[model samples]
Structure formats: structure tokens, C-alpha cells
Target: MARAPVRSSQAKVVSNILEKHGYQLGQYLGKGAYAIVWEAYFKKWRTNVAVKVLMKDKAEAEFLSKFLPREIQVWKGLKHPNLINFYQSIETTNRVYIMLELAPGGEVMDKIRMKGACDERTAGKWFEQLCQGMAYIHSKGVVHRDLKLENLLLDQHDNIKISDFGFCKFAATDVKNLKQVQLSETYCGSYAYVPPEVLQGIPYNPFLSDVWSMGVILFTLRTGKLPFDDSNLRRLLKQMIKGPIFTQKHASISLECKDLVRGTLASDVHRYSLHTIFDHPWMLPLVRERPPYLRDMDALYLRPHLRRSTQRLMTIRHTDGGTRSTANLVSSTRLVHPEALRSPSPPPSPPAHRPPLHARPPLQRSWGGREEGGRAESERERERGRGLAKDGRRRE
Candidate 1:
């Protein structure tokens, strides 16, 4: 049955649901193009939940009516410890609210910025959780078309919760039934992390594209740099066609990690499986979720460990005994300033490493042209106040 649209008297019921559940929006977690996340409390669990308020736009209004109902249906039956829990969804004319697991640590990008890239052991743990999430999503027949560091959010315990399914698709269609979708294009998703096939506008295997996206994520996590950079898209595409090799020996990373990178970058269409890269022993620690006491690991190890107010999982501390600050990351998201946060579509795929079967968009050097000093792409400055881009670009 078609779920009744959220309007008129129903909107008030939505708010009542929140009040009834005793969850009050505490602080705004962050925002996306059409969504804003807020930290709220669940009186029953006495815990925090990330309430994703996906607003209704002229373009998205109709989509949400169908999308939200569909998402709720799908989420209702799915249960897994690793998966982010979807508590409830309520809708008003102004917004569709999805109550989700709150991961306060922010995106992996936040970690990259704070720590300048993590070590192999740290990177592997993340890789394992990511795959576990992907594996779960795959098991449910859902294709998370968009997978990036930003999409993978970290909990208070620093465990990742794979969120954001705005671009997801259910595998209920065959070539004949899905013909309409099979021909779809627009290179949707964060550009820098997009798979090659999607860029070429071809029918893509969802799982493979997701893993390729994962590789880009791993690359960014360990190297503190993008893989397939060039002066221009033409050059980038040429190198991609030719297959670029990445050697991170200068970065003081381990050979096992390098092997992982190589394994991740190896994109033979014939050799695709979660176990393909999943079999690596180094990835074991990450795939297994840390015990409930993980947040306390730092406390146990640090000379003067400070227990966190939240779940007491493994405590994480740098060699200096100071915890990495994710405060900046949590607040710096474009959602903080919705009117100014419209972004172009993310550079969807073809990481700095090997090119997928497709050529990528031009590598944008954010560093101003000759007008600016000889700053590389990383040095580009963004004004704090800009409107959203019609393209699905990231707010960054």
C-alpha cells in the first residue's frame, strides 16, 4: 500500500513522535545537499541518535514521498550489529526525518585532516568495517551507489556507520526490467572516489564499483593524498587508460599495506568478490568489531587515560597521548550553512591510482590559476558562503 503522504494533520504527528520518544534535537550533526543531521536523545535507550532531516526540494519532494517510504520498508526488516540502526522515519511537508545511529566522530575525511592520514593498522580496521557494511548491504540486495569517506561516518566509539542511501538502488530488476536504469548516467556520487565504469556511462556492477570506491577510500586514508591526479582531465584520462602505478614507499608505510593497495587497485572485472581482498589476514582486526570496552583502550594504555562519557570502547590516542580532535570535522561540514553549501557532483571515481574502464573528469586544481601563487590543487581556498551547486558536488 502507498504510505499516506506527510501533510496536514500528519505533520504534527511526526513532531509528536519525537516528543513521545523524548528525543530532542540537541546539536546539529551536519548537513548535506538536501539533508541535515542533528544529534538527538532517545529517552528509552538513554542514547544518542542521528536524526537525518532530509528536506523536500521541488526536485526531491516527489522522490522522497516514494523514497522515504521505500527506505523505511527496507530498513524495518533489516537488522545487523554493524549496520546503522534506523529507528523511525517521520515526515512533514517541510522535511522527511530519518532517525539514525549517531556517529559523532564525523567522516573519515575528518580523521585525514586531523591526523594527516592514519597508519596501516588503523587503516585496516576501517577497511574491515567498511567491507562488513558493504557485505551487509550486498546481502540485502541493496546497491549503495555512493560510497566515500564522507558517506562512512564514525560513531562515538570511532566505529563507522555506513549512512546515506539517497543514491542506493534495490536489485529487483533484471536487464529487461532494469533496462531503463541500466542506461542511466550522470556519473552520480563523489567524483574523486567514483568507479571508472560509471564515468564511462556504462551499465555497472554495483558491488565492483563499491569496492573500487573502497580502494579510493583506503588510498586516501593511508596516503593523505588522492591517487590519479593530473594537470587536466585529458591527461588524467590518458594515464588512466595506460594504468598508473602507485609507489608509497616514501611515505614509510608497510609492505602489507602496499600489498593491500595493490590488491585494491587491481581491477580485473573477472576477479571481483568481497573475499578477493577480504582474505588478507591483516584485514582481520578491523573486520571484527572492537569489544564494547574499546573506547577505554586509550585509558588502559595512556599513562593517565581519560574515560569517555559515551560507550567505553577501545580508547585511541596518538603516540603523544593526546586524542585526535574530531570537533573541527564534525562542525566543518557544509550542512552548518545550508544556503552556502551547495556542491557540484563529487568527482565520481578513477582514483589517483589505476584508471577504471572509464576516463574521469578534469582534475580541478583548486589553487587559483596563474593569479594565485604556485599552489597545487590542495591549496585551493573555498569561501565559507556559497550556494549549492545543481550538480551533486560535495560541499567541500
Candidate 2:
């Protein structure tokens, strides 16, 4: 059955609230069963933010009464650089609005779809950030319960941001006098990422289940495929219960990487803790080179611009004229924001007439070939071009 739409009056009320708060709604970011996300400009702050609008009616009263409050409680207290930043929330007679830090770089799943498989170094960097973010949240007694690729977003700088707190729960509120570790019987998260125990309808440690999801992520990163992919739910569950994830012999990944994947995918009793995963030989190099966390000011300014650029690019790609001349448009955008090159499109082959946006100068290490400076240069050039071409009419 088709879901009911928010009443026109309710939507108008939401628009009024946004405008009253100095936010101008821009483009649709995405939608789910209960909420819709839009890119909006916060005029007062001179920043771009994502507004998640959730409709509240009799049908969704239970969700509004339970999950929404829990989500707000967890999001309001989170301050990690690798987790999505929640600015504030507003409530109305018929709806709720959540203002959030937008990650314009899109989901890790999109990147996987574009590049087939990620190089080990790139995957390691992302994995390290995921571990740090997960560790921070777990320390606060919250278990994410969902840790799939779609829930993992990337910022303009390629940093990971863990999102979607709808299924998040506190394992223990008071750690001082904890008598026993908390366990949850809730069956949540995506089917492919769900741990075997959760599928068996048994009480399980949420933290351990999260670790299993991470293991699935690592496997997908290396192979561009799920470890237990199947259309049949029963067959998939059986595969999850079976030991070992098969890796391609020809794939370029270290044995230590495979070992970590295997260990994280193990049953709850043998699953590695987040700390142990961080200390693993495969993750140690990234740990040693970890950058300082983003300050509040840095995030406040950078996030908006990135989101705006992403919206512009997406809008352009969808136009008929833009579709035909996508190469030039893509190159032009890349000239200004090299990170745009990594957007969900397949890795482009360099045109014979011109150098590709991703072409990099020789570097000291094979794995260090993807240059940050190159991306910065492209972005600068693209901005200049935009200024010069402002008078040109856009193709409809």
C-alpha cells in the first residue's frame, strides 16, 4: 500500500518554521518511510544544512512517541568528528524538523558502486575513522545497531561520518555499578548486515552485532560484494551462520586485513572489540597518522559549501543538455572541486584529447598516488571558471 502524504497544511507549517528560523529550503536530499531530507541554507549562520522533516499523525504516533525521542537524545549529546553533527530540532503541532550537518560526499556504498573495489590504503583510512567514531559512541553506552555502508557517509575531505540513530539504544546508562552487560532482543538493521544471532531471534549483545556489521563492511570494501549475499533470506541466514568469508586470491589485500575481517565476522564470543580492531596490525599505520578532530567552527563553515556544490552537480547531471555534455561539465566541476571527481559515477577513462581530472603526478609511494593537493587545485580552477561563465545561459 502506498504511504499517506503529509497534509498540505502541515507542509506549509514546516515551510513557515524554516523561513522563520532564517533557513531557505533548497533541494531534496533523500527520503525514507517516515521522513524527508532537504538541503537548506541557514542564512543566519551563512551555512548549508540538511533538514530532516518527519510528519506526525495518528498512524505514526507510536514511532513519534518512542523512536524520535530516543534518536534526539543520542544525537544531541554526540560530538565526534566522524559522527553526523546534529545542530538542533524543532517541534510543531504536526511535524518535527531536525537540522543536521550535511555530508556532501555521499554514502560509501555509492563509492563502492563507482570504483568496484577500494584500494587497501583508502579502505584502511576509512575503517580507522569508523572504529574511532564507533568507539566514541560505544563509550557513551550507545549501540548503533545499524552500521552498513549506506549509513556511513563521507565528507568533502573523505572523512567518514556515522549516521542514522533510529535504531540506536543505550546499553547501560550507569557504568559505575553495572551488574551485567546489557543485551537486546530487538531485530534491527539491514538484512545483509544483520548478524546470525539476531536472525535466530535470540537476545544478543548489540555491540557484538555492530562489530559483525563492520566485518561485512570490510569484506565489501575489499571485494565489492557482500560476504553472504542472497535473495533468499533463509539461505542468507544460513550463510551468515557458517564460518569464514571467501576472499579472492588475486585481490591485492594483506593477510592481516583478511584476518581482521574474519575475526570481526566471528560469533559474538570470539568477535574482536572495537579497541582490539584499532590495535590490529592492519589498522596501526592509520592510527599513527590520524589527524586532529574537526573543531566546531571548521565543521560549521565547510559543511555547507560542500553540500551546495553537490546539489548543483546533481541538478546539472539530470538535465538533458547536461547529460550529453557531462564530460565537460564533470571536468569543469573537478577543476574547482576535485572531490567531485569521486562522486558516484564510474571511474572515467582519460580522454585522448585531454588529461583526466584524477591524473596525478608521480608520488613517493604507490598507494599515496591520490593527491589531496590535486583535488584542491581542481576545485580552485572550477570556481574561477564558474565566475567567468556566470553570464552564459544554462541549458534547460
Candidate 3:
């Protein structure tokens, strides 16, 4: 695909601006549809950073004008160990530069591709991190419209960092107002990972869609394959809408893990909420084992003037009567503590009186399970009954 050209003048302008701000742009990292990432050295902080440069042209100016700023604003408010850190954004006449943390361990998808599949323990650890990250973002009233293996990067310690906010949007900031906020109907996301509601062209809750995508990721991690896969797009969509994601009988995975997947991939009524997923039998151990909040003291100790100056530049361009901007938008750049980015209290512990895993009733089943055969027969009978009723009505 042809990318927008970064002219020599624009390049020099960006370079001078970075130099003025005590940053040295280094080697090229990667490129996407609208941006190019480069390794950069921040002389002031004495740390390596990833700089994402987005070129602007007349053709895409309007779209970039709205999207780029929203992305910057979203990143500025988010600070979590499992999320990619955003430093600042620099905008010029023809380009926008985003400073971010560099994840040298590369993408999770690459690792999965190399190993085919991961053990349940490893998958559980990664899934915990993914959930924590998602929880943080959702708490901030943002929904990552796209959550897949490819967008998950790893740090040196093998910790997951959720990246790529191009498709993210603010859903709701106030808990009480959640139902009143307009639901998103935009059809966007990777086809293989998209939820049934989205594919059916219904206005869907973005958070639920994100949860579905996470379920897809979990399934991929366990089996190294998509839960719903087919060459024909229509066939794949049909399978997704028809219900049930059949796991291979030979795949060695526990029922608890399968239950989590089924719960997440279930219809809206039966789907597990993000908070509920955290307390699930398969997730409780990993959640309790989460590492302590690793604080970057330097960020908290940033010079007051420097912080104020950055905040002044973080302008949120508003179009339409307060309808376009995210709710609870941080107008003033307050000193964000690591603790402030997360919930003030710890996550709730699982109930002490809960039954052991083996004793509990089977959770919702997607495909092959103890009751799979019975469920299949039941579904067939229901379908036949519906067909006969339709035939009689037509005859009448």
C-alpha cells in the first residue's frame, strides 16, 4: 500500500523540533497504514523511546485532524503496567509525532506463531495481564475496539503491554450514565476476531465487543488457532452467528479454562462482564499473583513547569456541541501517580465458600463438552420445530 510521503522539509522540521526538545531520532522501527515508528533517545530523561510519526496530507487531513488528537488525549490519561506508556505528542504543519515506551520483546502473535500454542499456565498468566490492562482502560471510559494477539507486545520480563489505540474510543465515564450513552454501531475490527453482534450490523456495546475479542485471543493462545475459521467470509460469519466454537477433542485444556472462554464468547445476556472474568475460577490464581505496581518515580517528579507547559499544549479540539469529545476529559495536566492510573482499592477476592472446580456445575458450553451431544440434539429439534411451524403458516 502506498503511504503518504514525508517530505524533506517536513523531515527536517521534525528533526529540529526533536533536537530542540533534547531527543535524538534513531533507526526506523516499523510502519502502519498512517504512521511510522522510530527508535528515539530522550537526552533529558536519558531513556530510549519509540516515536510514532504520522504524515498528514490534504486527502486525509480531516480524518487525521479528529483521530490523531483523540488518540493523544486517550494516551495521556492512561498509565498502566500492562498498557503501552505514552509520553507526549508533538504536532506540526504536516506531521504529528507521538512519544511512547519501547517494547523490545516484540509482539505476542510472533511468539505464538513460533511455538504453535502455549501451556495453560503461561496462557493464564498472559490472560491475567491482558484483563488487567483492559480493566484499566475500561475504567478510564475507553474501549479498545481492536484487541488481538498482534496488538499485544511484550516487555523484557515477558509482561504483556496492550498497544495500538487507533481504533479506541471513549464509551462512558460515569457509571450511572453508561446506559444513556449512545452505543457504537460502527463496523470495525479484524474479521476473525469480531463478535457476532458487530457482524450482524447491530448497535453493540464496545466493551462487550472488546471482551469477545479477548475471548478469541484466549482461545488462540490455548489452541494456536482461531475459534471460528473458514476461507469463505460468508461461511465464517454464518458459523459465528449460528453459535458454538468447537474445540478439538485432542487439545489438552482444562474445563475451567474452557468455561472462561465460553462465558466470554456467550451471547450478550450470558457473557461474563470484565470484572466477573477477573474473579473466575481459572483467573483468580493469576490475578492474585499479579506483580506489585512498578512505579516510575521520575514521572511523578517531573519539573512542575515542564509538566504545565506540556499540559498547555495538550489541546482537545472540539467539533459539535460537546458531543464529539470524551467525557471526564482531563483539562488540566495533574501530576499522575502510578496509583492514580489504577483503581484506588484492590480487586475483590473470590468467595471463600465457592465449591471446588470439579464439584461446580459445567459453565456454558460452546461446542464439545460433557453435554455437547445433548445440546446439539436439542438445537436440532428446536430448528426442526421452527421449520415446521413456518411451513404450516405458509400453507395456511
Candidate 4:
């Protein structure tokens, strides 16, 4: 059976529910199998926030029982610059609402899709941030099993914000030494990002798998393509076992960059640890320039659709004798964040070198009238004609 599209009626109902809690739902952001995300204005925060809503009835029992709880547990405690900020979570009788920091810059994948692959410097800058975020996550004994380009988002400043904790797990630790307890047996996450150990159905280190996923992301960012083709699952597993084959397609990437990729995607025994990746020669230079910010050139890769939405949000309403801009409305309501008003593209400047008002020609109306000085000129002409007629009459 075909699934129905998100109904406007349903959205209206949800919007009302959110309003009761001091939130006003804006446009639809995105959705997954179990949840829908919306851009919303939170009154208390006086900021625009992302709200993830999961319907209890629609979601799977397994998610409700296991993954959802784990995600919330992991997300609530995390505090890092690169990680998305978790505001709060609310549970009602039939739904669960999770509020999060909205990254205005949108997804990293959006940039790649809009423009081709990122240049080496740009890619390296983001990759370094990703590593830092992962390092922090691992330190907390959490593993992000679903790492991918799509999950990495950018904020207004264009710094990476790691998001989506649905598949995350707290790594089991031994009590005596407080070291890792055992390998994760669950084969979960996107097939394209999963490593060979995960594909072989063997117990695998979740942290290492995440690193492998990061490697895949880096490769795609540099080459504009996934390292391995996954059309044939059987062949893909074999190909992964054989290791990623570097080709002429990858010739543009530096030797050091290739070395990092090779290290991360290596066999389970030889896979590069997150610590090792941080210390690698390729990543060393990028480390100094930590917490990378977006450059003017990088702005070209930003999602156009998001830019349009931002412009729409800040649009001014013009009416006769009354002008009410969205910015004013936001201020009055104390709803939208100031960031929402910022457009990626600057407003067009007025044309340079305007003629002096007296020197400028009067605008002529198409229906045989002057827009400005033409009326005065016409009146003078009429008076002159009448005087000429009077003179003729006198002479007669």
C-alpha cells in the first residue's frame, strides 16, 4: 500500500499542540520513517528551534523500547561545540517531542549536492572538526553508529554540528579498569557507511565503525562519490574485504589524505584508532586551525532551498499606510531568533551615481500625461495659447 503524504490537517493539529507549549511551528524541515522535523519558534528561548515529533502509534515497538530511550539518554548529557544542543524533551500520551538547536547552514550533503566535491583545504577543515566531535563522543563512552555526510550539519557560522543520535549507544565498560567491555554484535546503520566487519556479521567495535564511516564521508567530500559501490551487496562485501582501490579519480587528493582514508578503512585489526587519526600527518596541519569557520568560497556550496526559506521568513509585508515587516513581528512575539533574519546573500545595493533631482528628466506616463514636471509645463502651454487667441481677438 502507498503511504499518504503529510496532511495539512494533521500539521494544523500538531501546530496547535505546540502553541500550547509556547512553540509556533514553521515550515516542514525533513522527516524519517518514524519522526518528522519542523522549524519552530520557541517563545521562552526567543529563538528558532528544530522540533522532532514522533507519533507513538506510527513508530516501531523496538524504537520505543530501545533506541528512543538510548538516544534521549545519550543526547541529554552531551555538551560540545560541534554537537547539536538538546534543549528539552516532552512526552504526551500519543507523541514525543524533542527540541534541538537549528543549524541554519543545513546539511553537509546539501553542499556536496549543490556544488561538486569540496576542495582539499575545505574538506580537511571540516574533517578535523568531525574528528574533534567524535573524540568528545568517544570520551563520553558513546558511539555514533550512524555517522555519514547527511548527519553532519553546519551552523550559521558554517562549523560542523554532529546530529542524529538515534543509532548511538553507550559503549559497555569493564568495572575493574573501566575499559571497553565487549564488541557490539548489532549490525545497525546505513550499509554504505558500514565497514567489512559489520557486513560479515562478526562482532565489531562500534567506535572503529564510526571512524570508517567518517573515512567514507571524507572520501565522498573530496571525490564527489562514495568509495565503494553497494548495488551488489555480496560483491560490495568482497570489495571492502579487498580494500578500497585508489584510482585516477582520486589523483587530485594529496598523498597524506589518501593515507588517512586507507588507514581508517583498513581491516578490523589494523583500522586506525580515533587517536591515531588525530595524530596523522594529514590531519596535523588542520588541527592547528581548529573549529573551522566557513569561508566566502564555501558559502557557494550552501543549500539554495534553505536560503530561499530564510528570505521568506524575513520578508516584509507592505500595505497602504502600514508596513509590518516579519522582523517586527518576530520582535513583538519574541519568537524568532535574530539569526533567522540573516540571509546568506546580502541585499542588492541601490544603483550607484543617481542624477541630481533637478537634472533628472521627469518620468512620463504612458497615457499622455507627465508623472511630475509635465503637468506644470502643460498648464503653461495652455495659458500661452489662450493669450495668443486674446491678442488675435483684440486685433480683429
Q: Which residue runs does candidate 1 get wrong by more than 4 Å?
A: 1-17, 57-59, 172-186, 230-232, 242-244, 248-251, 268-271, 281-389, 393-396
Q: Which of the numbered candidates is closest to the native, going by highest TM-score?
A: 4
Full-model lDDT, candidate 1: 0.50
Q: Count the backbone clashes (under 3 Å) in each candidate.
A: 28, 6, 0, 0
Q: lDDT tens string, model 2, 271-313?
A: 6777567768888877844333322111111122223323333
Predicted candidate 1 versus true structure: per-residue lDDT over 32-112, tens digit per residue: 445655567777788877777666773354455565566677766566655667788877676677888776666666567
On lDDT, the candidate that comes out on top is: 4
**Each prediction's Cα RMSD?**
16.1, 18.1, 19.6, 26.0
The TM-scores, one per candidate, come to: 0.64, 0.69, 0.68, 0.70
Model 2, residue 297: distance off in Å is 30
Please write out the lDDT profile of model 4 over residues 152-181, one tens digit for every residue.
889998899999887777764642332543
Ten-residue stretch with the least lDDT total in model 3: 325-334
Ranking according to lDDT, highest score first: 4, 2, 3, 1
**Span of ten consecutive residues with least summed lDDT in model 1:** 325-334
Q: Higher-TM-score candidate among 1 and 4?
A: 4
**Which residue segments of model 2 deviate by more than 4 Å?**
1-13, 176-179, 247-250, 288-396
State the TM-score for model 3: 0.68
